[model samples]
Target chain A: MSQGPVRKILLFVDGSEECITAAQYAVVLARTLGAELAALYVVNVSVLNELFKARIFIKMEQMDYEHDLEQDGRRYLNYISELGRAKGVSIETHIEKGVVNEVVVEKARILGADLLAMGELEPIKSRSDAFHDESELILRKAHCSVLVVKDADYIERLYQAME
Target chain B: MRISGLLSEKTISRLTRTDKQGVIEELLDLAMNSGQVHDREEALRAILAREALMSTGLEKGIAVPHAKTRAVSEITMALGVSEGGVDFHSADGKPSYIFFFLLAPENAAGPNVQVLAQIARLTHDRSFCEDLRKAESPAGMLAVINDAE
Candidate 1:
């Protein structure tokens, strides 16, 4: 079998259950392909800006909300990093503050990543309809190949087998 | 209500170094001299370890290199301005001119995160960043931060 040309992989994670499932697959792929892995968690600044403009949160309160979101991003990135470590796949973690799709694509390009991996999209609520949805936008505009994992159970099973 | 309250004149200065490690070291030295950080070596190690995990260089010529460690008693912040941009490996592929080095207690994650978010929000404005770059002295930098708030 000819070896794949993938040398670097970038994974976008948002701490969702589905994202965790996708992260498991990313780890396995990185280990199998001997590729360097990087995980990114964007703080979704555009959504926060909308909430601020809508006066849903006062200035001080908005700062607090942004802080909570960043903490969440850090936790999720750290979790993925740990998972990658356990499987002998070193994963670098990044916490970017910006629009989700834009940041993901920009980071991928900057890292010279060969492939971008993300979880399948969850149902969007009404409140999120106002902004550009990240999943579809990332798929359509990514500069590199993209892998969207839809089968959470299958990935989870593979992850468990590695333990 | 302004984040500038966290920064003192002594904690702000111009960075002469053109590399990320040297810049971080200089900022950490400033934090130590200000008596905000108890152990300089430990704080430097912690910050570098975090940097190794990910470059904190954001877009728009700004880099917020931060770490939550027990080396500091509180959330300590130091600002460095580099006239000749340093290679921070920012996502935009541009050199970073403004550097914010932050050290916080492990238990103060909430406030630490808030300070980072506040810095990000403030620097997102191109005008504000321009003013920050023009400020030549530590007091000038503080004034820019205060005026922006």
Candidate 2:
């Protein structure tokens, strides 16, 4: 069954407080548009490698942190699924390991998403900060329409209003 | 997810049980107080069935008895410390001093796997396990977990 302009929504989450809010918004949007929803979590392995090169973490510590981050990504993705489940929206979940923005863009492209939903971007303190921010990079790189979710209270109410 | 949020003073205990079955019961009782469990008997059966397949004992004084069943509303966890040590048929053939009991909804396979991984990582740090075992009260034990996260 075809909905409106949106058919599939790919939600990119990174275990952030805002991602939970974004997930809520995505669930509500999916239900309203009758669109399929998939939540993606990237392990951001490159950041760990950067830390290792910076001498902030030794080999063992880097491996351990990498393991923890992978687990965290799975946990966050599962959380989004449960949120969708509660609203009677079946959500698919995916976890990948790579640079966060690159992985998200690749997954969205592969999934052929009609909309790419993400948490509110962090305040860009400078052009360099914006250049380095993964969320901003995702917004710039995605081929589909992007939805940067905000207003946690409003999203919560919308989610709660759903059956 | 913060491990601390899933646990509290109400969901932790200094186990009075000295045996494996006794300790499981004690932990389940603590889980009941969390108000997340839907069916106590089903949860217990699921845990025991998991034990029937293999022991959750991961060595180094830690035993993580867990299950995924419809009996839990979400992923619920209860922790216990056995000062005298309980024999859990650990991989290392050693007594288990700390127990991390986890119950998840049957459909929550992904989260269950992640929680198990997180527990494995926590158990890898002997000092963290030791701190939890040395904790005098549930609050103290909770503090150790909060600090580790």
Candidate 3:
């Protein structure tokens, strides 16, 4: 008998605080559908320039705490891997040095992933309520189905239900 | 402003004060130091109060927690480099690196969108994030950001 199309999930990570939100969603989806998780990080190599002078921007008494936005990506991927291992889910990670949306979508296509999970870059503070939201701009433009997660709670709901 | 609006390189950790209280304190400090905010405590409370409503953590090792304030005359930004990443409670479950502690007057919405779009443009580049991590010093990090702009 013929089988349905395979459902692979692609996650875009940027070492931003929001990645945590993206991972939560991807992890639950991976566990439920028994799909594989592919984590990818796009490394931007242009932060080391001189004209920008945007580095070493802060410190505590001459100590170098230059942000390690890239190194932390590996650490995060490890965390995702651990979460997957514990859940008995298959997980894979890819770190590419390029643009964020382009590399993420490209990686997903190369892997034939069906879904893309990502977090917001910034949040909007309004009088009504503060919104933790990602740009629907990228989501709408993505080739595959995009699941933009605003809250980390959605993942918890899945875990609670699964349990 | 060559082009991009990222902040000073990563630091050992300024918001050394962890927790929600600490984050609010640091954000207040940033907004004030930015000269855009008139009152540190007020701005801090504003940002923290917003966070209490919902965490700004976006998931993927980044968080953009901010608040609206009448104190700020224009949109101002600050960079909080955390050595010991905080538990921002991001959706993906990771810490933050490049924090854009944004503050603007309650009235201006255009500048807010302009800055957000700029931030999005920066993240859109992966090599930029890679270079950000590779940077060992503040100058190195700034150099990368400048070139990207």
Give the winner by TM-score. Answer: 2
Which runs in model 3 stand beyond 4 Å of their true positions? A1-6, A46-67, A124-137, A160-163, B1-149
Candidate 2, after superposition: displacement of residue B14 in Å? 1.3
Off by more than 4 A, model 1? A1-3, A124-131, B1-149
In terms of lDDT, model 2 sits at 0.82
Docking class of 3: incorrect
Q: Pick the candidate with the highest DockQ.
A: 3
lDDT of 1 by residue, B1-149 (tens): 24687889988999998888899999998777668788888999998887776677777788888776789888888999999899998767899999888888875544554466567667778998999999979999999988776
DockQ of 2: 0.02
- Show the colliding residue pairs in model 1: none
TM-scores, each model vs. reference: 0.51, 0.59, 0.44
Ranked candidates (DockQ, high to low): 3, 2, 1
- lDDT tens digits, residues B1-149, model 3? 22234354332124565574676567556556545567766777777776776666654445666666776777767655566677777656777655556766665433453454455456557787666656666567667667665
Please provide, for model 3 over A88-137, each residue's C-alpha lDDT reduced to its tens digit, 9 standing for 90 to 100. Answer: 77678887764445666678889988888887646433211122122344
TM-score of chain B of each: 0.96, 0.97, 0.79
Clashes of 1: 0
